[model samples]
Target: MNAHHPPGQTAPQDRPARLTVGVVGAGRVGPVLAASLALAGHRPVAVSAVSDASLRRAAEILPGVPVVPPAEVLARAELVLLTVPDDVLPGLVAGLAETGAVRPGRILVHTSGRHGAAVLDPATRAGALPLALHPAMTFTGTSVDVQRLAGCSFGVTAPEELRLAAEALVIEMGGEPEWIDESARPLYHAALAIGANHLVTLVAQAMELLGTAGVAHPARMLGPLLGAALDNALRSGDAALTGPVARGDAGTVAAHVAQLRAHAPQAVAGYLAMARTTADRALASGLLKPGLAEDLLGVLSDTANAASATDPADASEGPEATDDGADGGDL
Candidate 1:
């Protein structure tokens, strides 16, 4: 590993210099990132944690790293990671810059997917190098996240002059950096939120629905099915869709709606919404026959109208197998 380069200078792209790293919000993401950087020979010198969970994570993930205030963290480290929530990032950057804590030639990297390098303009004007390097993986605030970083993709944004530095930092943490244009940061984050965040909600709902339907081991039962479905979806995109909605089986879809409304009223809205989307995509792809879509769409609209008429509890899961498909398979 390359030793720390002098301040205001960068090491060669192929040789990432080991620098003193500090974490400004020791949340689920901060400690894990610092830990990953530590593995790459970067020294974690200080961390800031306000909450019990964050404090614990900081200690557990970066033992011996002094717990300090944010300003102190900036004072002691060459590379400071701002891993606060997206909503809190702008204010934090502004506050730090206003206090004159952001030193010239210091590296300020934020892990907010919703933002890009522009969010650090305050710090940038203070002469700190800015990078938005968002790792596209869920974290558990534990050592497990260190392993998860291997091969993970990061949405990276930086000034053209600092592109290589941003990429090198991500690579040192064992992540692949995908360049994100500053203007497209919000949409890029939205796509990740739709795919990863909403997926957890969908899976949790599925498990809950299964449990309510008398399945003793919901997770165990659904694990393989969901796994296979995910794999297929990743490989084939819209073509991987193979449920009642995609098949345009109005009967099965209507049955699912009725059952969800009766048994899991909360799931009715999500089901109808996803079904409508699936139907639309299916028709667009010519996978759903227009003649059959009329009935499928009718059921969705009717169910949505009914669901909106009454208040429903939050519920789980998606289209369950009601009837056999033409191939004698269930959703």
Candidate 2:
């Protein structure tokens, strides 16, 4: 029995008991996950790493493990981790299966948030046991990721018969497993991309605007405000929203549009789009009064129309034109 087995759960003698692991991709996520499995007593047999950084990380995390070709890795491993990019995964699986690399009774797992186990159907036909185990946390290709695995949630998708094994593997890696239907994987991934990836973009935009406004340290300026806003949004959802738009301050919003157009034209579209969406959400959540919302909508519409009407060649000619008397509404 492996030394790290949990109390009261002994390996059965009748079953094949070896837990040799192979990682097919040594990218940011792959090495960390393999290290976590190693911590849970699985032996790291081989890893396929093509890039210099990946090879370096593998050396650091899986010391003394052989860097082998994909087929060799698959041949040696009882558990194979396919951690390539989402776009590259299907082709890799098909290629591996075509070359007779996949074997019966071996557990094949992928770390793509966009795909479920169904993407491994080619390998399934070759008799591999397929499972999709996507960690919800982002990776940095370092030791820190291994520590972060504890208490993290993995979005799991697998065949009914293999559910227990999949969940057990995730638990062994110090992660909780949340089952996701195969059809729902795309939407699940989209939600994470919007929440995490797009959040980075939004923060970048905020910092750029702050810099334009002469803030010497944009990170310091935004850190507390963003942290509190994120905490409140998570705790209270739309009910926690606050700002000029949420408060139905049409005049302040118009002033913002005018200033952005005058000084930072590139930010105008994104600002208006988010503002409109925020207004819609606030209105739906009953956070903004209907009459006030109408006024805010009118101001936004007028600003959008004014922006569209202005010629690109004339952009530097003067301050952006605005609808006559559109900013007359009270807050």
Candidate 3:
């Protein structure tokens, strides 16, 4: 229940001299912030990670800090980090605001890439300053997240008055701060997804293709090569391309598609999709003749359709080409 005040009176604004922070969802981001804040001489008042084990671990890391309910944290701290999953943040903020846990003049922030500070407007309407601070790095719920934060970039969204404070917090955590508008949160997150998640999928597809030819530890084989290729791609755009597609080797591409359909039918769809995209890029780059590029892309697309029409076991059959060797396409 919310404490009542007379009309025209507002919630109190008596923040402690030291910034007391409460962290919710002590998962990867939460625990990292808790430990880092404590190490940086900030007062970590309370942290809640949902599960008993998670709370116990967080308490262990920040000794003497309470593992309490969300409302309790908001009640106790001048700064609160709603680091829960993206879907839950709005409900949590609304609940806290409705229950009067988030008082006037305090700051509330969330670390969701897909949402902005506006999602915390429920709390803001109750007079708490809302901020969104999303780190542009990946985490695996480990202590290494602290080290990864060093020199990483963060996307920060907040009202003008709160932006400086949010950026300062990220800088203190050893991350560069990039300010973005609240309305652009979705596009901002899409860029991260395209770069991070799609990159993983692309690498996995390459490895699976290599494995079809009995290459043991394909990931290990491709790691350094892929890293260098990526570095080159970043340094030089379309000119970095060097492969069968770039050379307009339609015959080789058709043979490769046929071989993939025979040996790794399971990977044919993704392989064909990427190959077609590559063909388009190659043609655009003037590396491929129009007629050759269309033919090659047609072959790749047909290979995918054929593969999808078959079973997984059928997809695992031997290649059409007898030579089961690596071509090492410069991706």
- Return the top candidate by TM-score: 1
Q: Model 3: per-residue lDDT, tens digit, 49-100?
A: 6666566657666678888898888888888877776766778888899998
Please give me the total number of clashing residue pairs in predicted model 3: 0
Q: Model 3: what TM-score? A: 0.81
Overall lDDT per candidate, in order of appearance:
0.86, 0.87, 0.75
Error of 1 at 320 (Å): 30
Better of 2 and 3 by TM-score: 2
Prediction 2 global C-alpha lDDT: 0.87
lDDT (Cα, tens digit) per residue for candidate 2, span 156-235: 99999999999999998899999999999999988888888778889998899899999999999999999999999999
Better of 1 and 3 by lDDT: 1
Clash totals for all candidate models? 3, 0, 0
Residue 210, model 2: lDDT of: 91
- Which candidate ranks first by lDDT, i.e. highest? 2
Residue ranges of candidate 3 with Cα displaced over 4 Å:
1-18, 56-61, 304-331
